[model samples]
Target: MLRPIRALAAAAAALALVCACNSASGGSLPGKPGDAAATRGVSAGSIKVGGIVSMTSASGYSKKDTDLGARARYLRANAEGGINGRTIDYIGAEDDGQDPGKNLAAARKLVQQDKVFAVAPMSSVTFSGADFLEQEKVPTFGWGTLPSFCGPQYIYGFNGCLVPSPGGTLNQTWPEGIGQVLGGAKGKSVAIIANDSDAGKFGIRTFRQGFAGAGFEVAYAKASVPATAVPSDWSAYVKDILASDGGEAPDAVVSVMQTPNNIGLFTALKRAGYRGLLSDPTDYDPALLAKDTTRQALDGVHVLLQFEPFESANPRMDQFKADIKAASGGREVPLNMHMLTGYMSADLFVSIALKAGKDLTVAHFQNAARSFSDTGTLVGDRAEPKGQKESFGCGALVRLKDGAYEVSVPFKCYEPVPFK
Candidate 1:
């Protein structure tokens, strides 16, 4: 979930003194003298980086492979001559356990204790340490589902900020792709549901505008489900959603929640005899197909993705698969979206750091980030500053059918619709 804007504002004000001190240091914090590394986590022989992920969570959701994904990317980078002659000293990852307090504690350990140069592949629902990292001027990379990612100079979202504040544009992938599947959205209707969390609420708000902008009648939009627990019974949500649009099921039901919630809701909906199209941002993981029940629950459901699907024939995807296999010691594992999130997050950070030149520091890194722009990346054409506020405007939709995924709406970039 995204951090609350009010909380971020409050913390920014409270951390003003720390931020000032850190900024004045010019990216050089007190550490070993004559290190010749220019920064805290850098040394003559290596550049140290760490990660934060919700490897264990209360909702049965885990981002464990995110560490593997980052490791894979870093291994490949090191194999390819180690990011300008300095091998990456990846300190593995710290598990936040999906706790806000733990998240902050982990961040503190990485910065204050570990003295790491940067944090990459930070995949967690709660990012309470965001303010601390910002105050310390630490460069962080992760998925931009949180508002903390937006408008933060030190934090970067791999695919750009998915949750932009007022005045920023919204990615039209989900709504536009759904519209294509429904032929046209002229008189069609949609119901958007999410967990009762900041991320879910912001997702509903953004997608409400997105679908409406694409001419679909928004029948129901709510963050009613609990975020911390998966509902065993979805009767209440199903009843309201099924009858949301003028006493009938909407043409499409869009879930902005994660997989567990989706499985319960979709299964209940199917049992309740609602046959409309099912769609969501999560549930793209191939691991979910390991269970017949899980597969059946998600059958014919469209999954939205910000990056190219693993099933794609793109050369970049081929390289990604190779890297994953190499990192896993030739073990073939199910490809999931979390892996991509971690891989892409690390990839962006390394790309910018490399551009920062042989002598790397936070100052150089931020400078490189400000001017960083790359086209034809796994996600999309990426640029800094603007990306700090908005998305790269690229994504695709895939559907699960008969225990396999197929391109329902081919990968493409769409012009973003301004968020109202």
Candidate 2:
């Protein structure tokens, strides 16, 4: 049965979503709220869950879904009975922002210092600290779709949606989609521009392989710049696009760069007056189109799909959305895939943790996670005509419509695109 969703204002909702997860569990567990050795209780005890997010970077401020949203949803979980009587204690979080090394340090601090039972919401740094998590037996989980990191005992990732994310279990969806685009487009040209970072390299290589398999010839592909690299004039970048190496000019340019650079690359494309279809993953926010005076510049540009949009037929998603909106003070809470990923991450983590039972050690949490599926989550319910397994339940491809995404197919799920 659906719980009563009390409507509140955005301020109230923010507060509600950010309540202290580690308070005196079931009366008093002692020490500053998040002491990992929280007292065991009959009905309630604090289950410390650590978080790492990009709080200090551009993505942190601009993206609605960040580590804060993950923590916020866990707070919401705590209000919902503390996950089988274990109140979540989001003891603390560190700001990795966009740095991979920082992510590793934060994860270490959370596990070694905070004594958290589990990590959630795709801490992003898990890839950096995968060894520590597996060695320590700390279960690291997330709504991330990247699959390469989803291995050993230390890592567990949620596909989040049928569509692939920049870094999640389904990161390979771009390559698969490119296959479809190229296989059908006859001899259409394709190009790629991703940073030189671990994720950037992975995204570029994976798609390059997939596109090649699908018989699409690459016109030109280059590592644009790393995330840490400061922005530059980018005139050379534009020249590179027009000069398609040895291959023919592409029918489209696929950029694997993050948002700020994405804007830059597109701006340069327009300045060069080159008219070709541009492609990007779903990482780019539709809202950015609002502020960009270069709106006319992106006409007919395409983006990859991670999952069908939430507005698609999904009773569970619709209800949770309403509940979230009500919790956010009656105003339509910003219900994008990012926030939904946070919610889904929170929900799945809770399910697996409690399913591990009161004897809950990190090992049990890990075991519970491997056996779990999206059978009861909002994403599962929202998916219609389910057919795919590794895919986020079942949903069709999506395209940016009216600056927002809309589903192009209802449940035409292909296999999980291989990013590994």
Candidate 3:
């Protein structure tokens, strides 16, 4: 969950970032004049950058929050005059609650009607229209942590970072997250569950590998959960989970489910009196627990977070904290790494655009965003370069501690068993 103090602190930092907010907006960034939406070789006047996040509905709220956070940060950038004298005239939209049909339509509208220079980082690509923008070569960005989508087809993902060398997960969240609740999994039997969708399958597979790689026994791994129809019936699926005993009682259940079914999963687990570690890839927020009547049910479960808790003093996220607060009109926001990831994605692409100069094109962004260096871009999780050596590595495994999900791991650097 996003903390209020951090949001307040970030708002305070935005005031300081005003000067460095967009120093490049002085007509210098590549996607500026002749680069943006210029047709027939003519330059677009005010460089428009388009984006889509999953902000509404039960399905894609996290993705919308990603869009929301990105927009908020970009709004702060725009207020400071944008990149290179051209404010990032952003036209932000959402997939509308994980509706693939809606995202398909949103993609068409962004490219056709909006005519943006480039579309940027988004998550949970509605399995419905995963190829629209990719086939268009529109220079898109994504955080498709679910490995199946990480194939060469998507072309753009994980802030342009690929599948972290096969076994290495860009989000490597499952075992690491469950590690917080179950500690060392040497003798533990783990059960993995998720929807039959590609994302679910891939997440379970990668997590299984992470667990096995760390010497844990994967007691059960299943992703054949039936989606039933359009809007999935999660209650039925949870019943399936509860019914699947007879074998050795698992010590943990790793799930890669999306928002549409998470609440049901939690409810069923609680009712069955399963007192083991329940974990999910840090995709959606567990805040849904608070919103739903199942708040008390998710008592001891842990949620994996791919990035640093926003409040960490890594110097990388300090400025964003201030900017997001000011952009949200001082309303202490609630979120995890989505907003931070979105902010860095946009900022990193802008850096690439600046580097690409007047030669700015979709190809340039793909090339530049792919080559991010540590000192150059400090986003949520660290992807250090040769010499710099990251001060930290991803977020400390997080959990539902004292009514709020706070950092349970000690310092940084992926400690499987977080000693208090």
Candidate 4:
């Protein structure tokens, strides 16, 4: 599912597929009075919305917290006077089960059956609905880790697309932050690996260049591991990695993989005595620490973060914590990157919706989003139209040390390199 969606998205990107349907110029839905399509999911006092999330998957991975994160943001938005006098009629998220068919079905259900005004926080790796949602002129939001987020007029990534087309700018945060951890990338070497899937291959392409651009010698870069299941043994992979750098282990190893894969790979690397920098984009959740095996496996590994760390004293961080607590029935929960994915996805949608003003319509929303900009968010300053092309270029590194997470590099913006 992830592979096919990415292949289609890549083909779509080649043609520069940016079609803001019915936006502002000459469409009946663009603020035309009495046009039902203009107000399909709107009422005098409410604006209906829904989400698509991979809450359950065959790989035993879940993004259930993403739904909760969206709920938290929406709850606070409602409490704060409901977006220009209209409450958000959030119908909640539909579980896509991470299947391509299920993903498209969920999107159709939201648009055709539930009649949502928009799909916010669409936090799933397999976004098979991108084409359908874009065709139907529905505004969709999610993390921009996939090709679908790039060059799509109707779909937007919360932090902009980290993986962009050639000639587009690449977010150097991960590479730059990792360089700081390694006392700079000069004379250093790294091995980058990912699951053997289209999405993973795209990640390797983007990041291999990124790390090399940051001045590290790319010892080995490959997307050769299995995607559907974690390998029971990692000796073959380990053998290649240890001998990647001129027949010696590289200085650092970076994984563009999810939790279970990271745990398995990191545990194997540690056992093999390759004690250089180990890092991944996922596995920052506190819940992993509860399991001694997971915590030990991830110990000393730095996790890349696109937003402010939870330990930050920033007032906005406090607000997010409070919002999550209230959303969770006053219970404290472990925070993770998936939660931020949903929160920021919702945040971006809410920000644009607010700009859309009292005349709520898909056209109005698209127009507003085209020129939307905000400052001091958890993900950093956001400016649209530009975001559709490049990332915000801000991130941090957090290391799992001694059963706790610490900020290895403070959140900051980095200069981006061309994606070529």
User: What TM-score quantifies how close candidate 3 is to the native fold?
Assistant: 0.74
Q: Which ten residues in a row have the lowest lDDT in candidate 3?
A: 19-28
User: What do the candidate models score in CA lDDT, each in turn?
Assistant: 0.87, 0.54, 0.53, 0.85
Sorted by lDDT (best first), the order is: 1, 4, 2, 3
Error of 1 at 216 (Å): 1.2
Instruction: Give Cα distance to truth, residue 229, candidate 2, Å.
Output: 3.6
lDDT of model number 4: 0.85
Per-residue lDDT tens digits for candidate 4, residues 260-355, read 989999999999998899999988899999999999999999999999999899799999999999999999888888888889899999999999
Q: Supply every candidate's count of residue pairs whose N, Cα or C atoms clash at under 3 angstroms.
A: 0, 17, 16, 0
Alpha-carbon TM-score of each model against the true structure: 0.93, 0.74, 0.74, 0.93
**After best superposition, candidate 1 residue 272: deviation in angstroms?**
0.6
Q: List the residue pairs that clash in candidate 1.
A: none
lDDT of 1 by residue, 1-420 (tens): 222233433333333323222222224666544333658788888988999999998888889989999999999999999978999999988999977778878988898888888999899876777877876778999999877788889999999988887888898889999999999999999999998776787788789999999999999999899988898789999999999999999999999988899999999999999989999988998889999999999999999999998888988999899999999999888889989999999999999999988878787788899999999988989999888899998999999999999989988999998876
Worst 10 residues of 4 by lDDT: 19-28
What value does the lDDT take at residue 359 in candidate 1? 72
Assess candidate 1 and give its lDDT: 0.87
Question: Candidate 2: where are CA atoms >4 Å away?
Answer: 1-44, 58-64, 123-127, 143-148, 160-172, 175-185, 245-248, 282-286, 294-299, 326-330, 376-398, 401-404, 408-412, 416-420
